[model samples]
Target: MGLYLPDAIRLHARERGTRAALSCADRTLGYAELHSRTNRLARALLTAARPGSRIGFLARTRTEAGEILIAAAKAGLVTVPLNWRLSEAELTALAQDAGLRVLLTEPEFRSAADAVHAALPGLRLVIIDSPAEQQDRQEQPDPPDSPDPSGPAQAADPAVPGYEAWLAAHPDDDPGRGGRADADEVYLQIYTSGTTGVPKGVLLTHTNFHAERAELEESRWQPGSVALNALPLFHIGGLGLLQMALSAGAHSLLLPDFTPEAAARTIEREGVTHTFLVPSVLHLLTELPGIERRDFSRLHLVSYGAAPITPALLRRSLSVLGCRFQGKYGLTEAGGTVTRLAPEDHRPGGPRSHLLGSVGRPRPGVRVVICDPGTGDPVPPGTVGEIRIASAHNTPGYWNRPQETTELYDARGLLCTGDGGYVDEDGYLFLTDRVKDMIVSGGENVYPTEVESALAEHPAVFEVAVVGVPDDLWGEAVTAVVVPRRDLPRPGEQELIDFVRQRIASYKKPRRVHFVGELPRNPAGKVLKRELRARLRQSHQ
Candidate 1:
């Protein structure tokens, strides 16, 4: 009987009926309209699927994406936001795993949706088109034999319904809590990045989200705040950011997809006060043409995470955006951020400036412990070990994976983060790297983030990923894959390696360096080191 997801919409609708709730492209929905539409969508979802069923959403960031989440919560269904960036095969695998009863997708992903439906005939498909697309379809009549473009898959399959039509058919009245789940029940099932292995669905309950909001620090919502939501909804950072904004009655400006230009334009035009961007996005923004001239006066805060951020990039972002920066450290299983690096800690030469390199202390109501990865025994402070966290925001477990779920926690019940890091004497959590990403070269342990951080300080190095490769004499050879800054003269491989050697221990330096145009990153801006390792191994073979 605690706070429900739909209750946020209902409360906002009653209190701020005429205020803008969500804006994307050329359309904006007021709180009242959003509440009413979600109610209808909830009833529609229930008509096609049953309560407790897994409802899937595979689309870009849009107002309809928010509608699906609120609707699923109201209909007592679990929302599984699928990554649209995934391939058809990957989508089919996740769809099968979730056993999704209904899938809400968009025209851009019609082929992928078709593939999923081909695999699961029982799965209902509903296409959600942008308002502009719908308007274009209404203006132009479809010609015979020509493939339908700028519209839903309704023409291809009679059974699959268009989202607007399906929603309009249902009553606008609130779908009473007859089928709603309790606060402890699963509300969102976000899949892991699967860098190490097969992606597992992390089951985050309603209480998990509520717990996250209660601990929000610098990113806390302010009244009448306009939030720019550019991250994809499939990622926890994206969905969680949207939820925080909506829950606080903040107007959200949704981006269909992230582009440096689009994000800059939206921030200036929309007068966005708060937003979240990954370090990679921030790098792009700082390097953008005429970026310094952009009117970021209204922008208040830029929260970033999901991957290791170099101090250089953080300083550059601070200089360019002229906004308070907050760093977050978290994963999907943690339901978002468990630690927040406050803006005050970001100062370069301040008394607590050394903490800038750390991910900061755990948020209120969260306890972080460093544990030996092998023995699961607590490690002393300042000793590198697996990061363990205990918090109300931690997911109950992974969906349908009891064995792995049980292993996710240690005997002490702290969720093992699988990240190698240590807490300093000042209580700051300094991340080294993913435990799996650690490189053991000639019996010396080398964390890639440490090497990458050092390499990133070089003027020529734009981005870098350090990994261990097969070696004859050594167990694994330390290798660095780098993307050099286009604006700066490219540094030689040995020169770049020597740059890191001067800063860190020589044994931790990269034995080999490979330059690339760009680093492969997942939707959440996390570098896909697994893919990079595989590529390097194949190339060596």
Candidate 2:
């Protein structure tokens, strides 16, 4: 068995040599080649990077994504995958916080990379696109009307260091003096969304990779099965998906980002048999053009999480894809996945139909509890409380923040998940609301999910987010931000409020309903309730 992550790649190369391992666009890398390339890159990186020094990547999901991460793991360097969607200032703050020594840049994010590099002059910036690619980009003529196809239309920036040249300088032989490495060392760092506050970096050790593996090994996906992953590589889902596929030596395809059309086409083209997605992505897949003609028959298991899925959407997915559905629940802090509703748990109308809404019982070697947030006492089953988790797969904690780390974990070695939810009598977990997202009105606690679920039942409602706004009399008034279904007329505030009152308690109904063109979401399809609360404060001010 592999002791560290890099050992897995080495094991695959020796045992599954010449087997196809990864695909991105038109390029595919075999396990042996992938192993060799990672070694070469690791040797080159060793020339500069020291143990614990952070190396960052600001590129989309591509072939280089795996190579960089694998090499970093082997060399004992910490890798930070930057969120390309963040502003230059936000990216700068994260890079500074990580004390980064190197950053790999992609052409699409050249401007942002340049800014980040300028802000941190001491940080080494290595452009993933070569010097010639940069020149070719400059030489391409811009059309009068459309944006430049090659890249940004701005004037050419001076040629900087190229990734290809950097890697080529080192020998392909395994410099047996591998970069620094250890089984317990922090191998990866992923930052939080910073919805509640500044994003903090989460440190994941080599052992942390086992959380999701425990469940994935039991999945129906076969060895060498073809799989496609469209989640952003920066997120835990994306990186963990790659590791999961590699665990079984499965053939993997990665996309730069998710698009319903690309995902459908890739599944059909690659004959992909397994894939995982967020609920939002699944909804978009259902809405794709020519979706009726798309061949999803090859898909064996379809897993989704990172956000809730309504029964309506789940029904649509089952009808459209004709595949077994798995509902998953996890957080970045938990490594990848802590629990999942098995495919059998998704029976639409079977005896255990109610389990569809639950994230499912914890997998083997995992422990979970619904506990009081303040006292850390486990609550009885069926009572909502902060979900606490104890697992060897859990991350060590935030990078370089000892105080924050100490506060995150309790004396029992269990960490409060910050998500408020309950466990059923059968040990199934049902999500209620986020602790920070809970609203208090006239001393009554209101979870937005209950109201949102009620409003979502309306035929005209498409997407909805519930928040609490300041009210002179009620202290905090329940407000619903809604996106109306395009095919129907918008529902009125009183009508929807009455709609909720009839379903749940009257106090939980929205006092006001605001229709929106769309809702703001992060990479993982999670609604930004923090942003909505900030908007309410600004309006009242």
Best by TM-score: 1
Could you say which candidate leads in lDDT? 1
* Candidate 2 lDDT: 0.81
lDDT of 1 by residue, 142-222 (tens): 556636554434533558877887887899877664223467778789999887789999998787775234543447675
* Candidate 2, backbone clash total: 3
Candidate 1 — what's its lDDT?
0.86
Q: What does each candidate score in C-alpha RMSD?
A: 2.7, 4.4
Worst 10 residues of 2 by lDDT: 150-159
In the predicted model 1, the residue pairs found to clash are none
Q: What TM-score would each prediction reach against the true structure?
A: 0.95, 0.91
**For candidate 2, lDDT tens digit of each residue in 1-541?**
2234577678789998799998887778899988898888888777767877899999988888888888888778899999999999889889989988888878788898777777777777777864456557657875365355554323333235567767777877664422224657888999987766888999998877632444555675446588898988888888877877876778889898678888999998888988888877887898676788787778888889988777667777888888888888888888778788988788888898777778888867679988988888999999889988998778899988999898788889897789999999888998888986788988899988778878877888877889998888888889999988887877788889899899999988898888888888998788888888788778778
